[model samples]
Target: MKIRYKRMHLRWIFVFGLFWLILGVISITNDSENYFNYGYLIASLFYFGNYFFKSKNQYLTFEDDIITLNNLIPKKLNLVDLKQIKRSGKDYILRTENKELHIKTKFIDKNSLKDLKAILKNLQTN
Candidate 1:
C-alpha cells in the first residue's frame, strides 16, 4: 500500500504567495524601488517553488517484506528487522537492529496514520 504525505499548512503558503504577488504589482505600479518589487516577486516565487517540490516527493509505501520511506530517497527497510516503535511528541521513531528512523507526524494525516499503524501491527505479528 502507498500513502501520500500531507501537504501540511498549504493554505498559509497560498495566501502568502498571493499577498506577495499583489504587493509586488502594487510596488511596480507606484514606481517603487527595484529592490522592493524584486523582493516581493522573489518571495512569491519561493512559495511556488516550495509548492512544486513538496507536493510530489514524499510518501510511505509498504510492499512485500520491505517498507519504503519515499522521502528524499527510496529507503527500503525490512519489516522483519524492526525492533521497536516509539512515538515522541508529534513524531514517530522506528528502531531496528541497526538503525533508527524518525518520521514527522505532520507528514501523514490522521487517516493515513491509522493505515500506517495497521501495517506496522501486521509487521509485528509476522
Candidate 2:
C-alpha cells in the first residue's frame, strides 16, 4: 500500500503572507513620517517565504517495506530495520537496530495517530 503524508495547515502561510503584504503596504504609505519600521514587514515576508517552501517540502511516504520522510531536511528509514515504535509525550519515536528517529506529532490528528499506531503494531508483529 502507498501512504502519503503531508503537513497540515498550509493556509496559515497564506494568511501570514497577506499580513506581511498589508504591513509592507502600510509601511510604504507612511514612509514620510518614518514612525513604522520596515524591518517587521520584511521579517514577516521572509518568514512567510520560508514557511511556504519548507511546508511544501515536508512529507512522509510509505510504500512496500520502505518508509521515506522528506521535510525541509530529508531523512529516510527502512521499516524492515525498525526494532521499536513508541510514543514520547507529543511525539512518536521510532527506534531501529542501529538508529533512532523522533517525529513531532503536535499537528497530527487523532485518527492519523491511531492509524500510525496500528501500522506500527503490524510492523512489530512480523
Candidate 3:
C-alpha cells in the first residue's frame, strides 16, 4: 500500500513558495542591488526543501517484507524488525534500535493516519 501527504499541506507549501518568489521579484525590481533579493531567495529555500529540492518524492509504501519511505532518497526498513511507534500531538515517531523515523501527521490526512495505524497493528501481530 502507498500513502501520500495531505493536499492541504501541499496547498500551503505552494502558496508560501509563490509568496517568497514574489518577494524576490519585488526586491530585484525596487532595489538597484540584487543583494536584498538574496534574503527572499534564501527564505524560499524552506519551500524548496519541502516541495522540490531536497526531496524527489515523499510517500510511504509497503511491499513484501520491507517498508519504504520514499523521500529525497528511498529508505527501507524490515517489517519484521519493527520496534516502537510513538505519537506526539500530530506527529508519529517510529524507532528501531539504531534508526528513528519522524512522520508529521499534519502533512497526512486523517484517513491515511487511520490506515497507517491498522497497518502497524498487523505488523505488530505478525
Candidate 4:
C-alpha cells in the first residue's frame, strides 16, 4: 500500500513559495541596498525546490514486511522488529528498539490516513 501527502497541502507550499518570491522581488526593487531581501529569495527557492521534489516523492509504502517513508531520505521499518504502536492526538508513533517513527495525520491524504489507521490497528491486534 502507498500513502501520500495531501495534494492541497502541497499546493499551499507552492503558494507560499510564490508569495516569498514576490515579496523578495518587491523588496529588491524598492531598496537595492538591503541584503535581507536575498534571504527571502533564498527561502523562495528552497520552498519551490522542495515543493516540486516532495510533491512527487513524498510517500509511505508498505511491501512485504517493510514500511518505508520516502522523504528526502527513505526510512524503513520492519514490521517484525516493531516494538510498539501508539496513537497520540493526530499522530501515530511506531517504536522499535532504537528508533521511532512519527506519522502525522495532518499532512496525509484523508483516504490514505484512514487506510493507515486500519493497518496500524491491525498491527496492534497482531
Choose the strongest candidate by TM-score.
4
Model 4, residue 55: distance off in Å is 0.7
Tens-digit lDDT track of model 1 for 4-89: 66655555666788889889888988886566677888999988766665565446777787777764456777777888877799
RMSD of each: 3.3, 3.8, 3.0, 1.9
Residue pairs in collision within model 4: none
Q: Per-residue lDDT for 1-126 in model 2, tens only?
A: 322233455566667777887887777787846745676577687778767765654445567777766565657788888888888886778888887777766545456566666787787788
Q: Which candidate is the best by lDDT?
A: 4
Give the poorly placed runs of model 2, Cα more than 4 Å off: 1-8, 32-58
Output the worst ten-in-a-row residue range by lDDT, candidate 3. Answer: 50-59
Per-residue C-alpha lDDT of model 4 across residues 15-119, encoded as one tens digit per residue:
999999999999999997989889999999999998998777766889998998877788889999999998899888899998888888888998998899899
lDDT of each: 0.73, 0.67, 0.73, 0.89
Span of ten consecutive residues with least summed lDDT in model 2: 1-10
Residue 65 miss distance in model 4 (angstroms)? 2.3
Where's the lowest-lDDT run of ten residues in candidate 1? 50-59
**Model 4: residues with Cα > 4 Å off, grouped in runs:** none
In candidate 3, what are the lDDT values of residues 15-64, reduced to their tens digit? 79889978887888889475767788777777867776322454677789
The C-alpha TM-scores of every prediction are 0.67, 0.67, 0.74, 0.85
Task: Please estimate how well model 4 matches the true structure, expressed as its whole-model Cα lDDT.
Answer: 0.89
User: Roughly what TM-score does model 4 have, to 2 decimal places?
Assistant: 0.85
Clashing pairs in 3: none
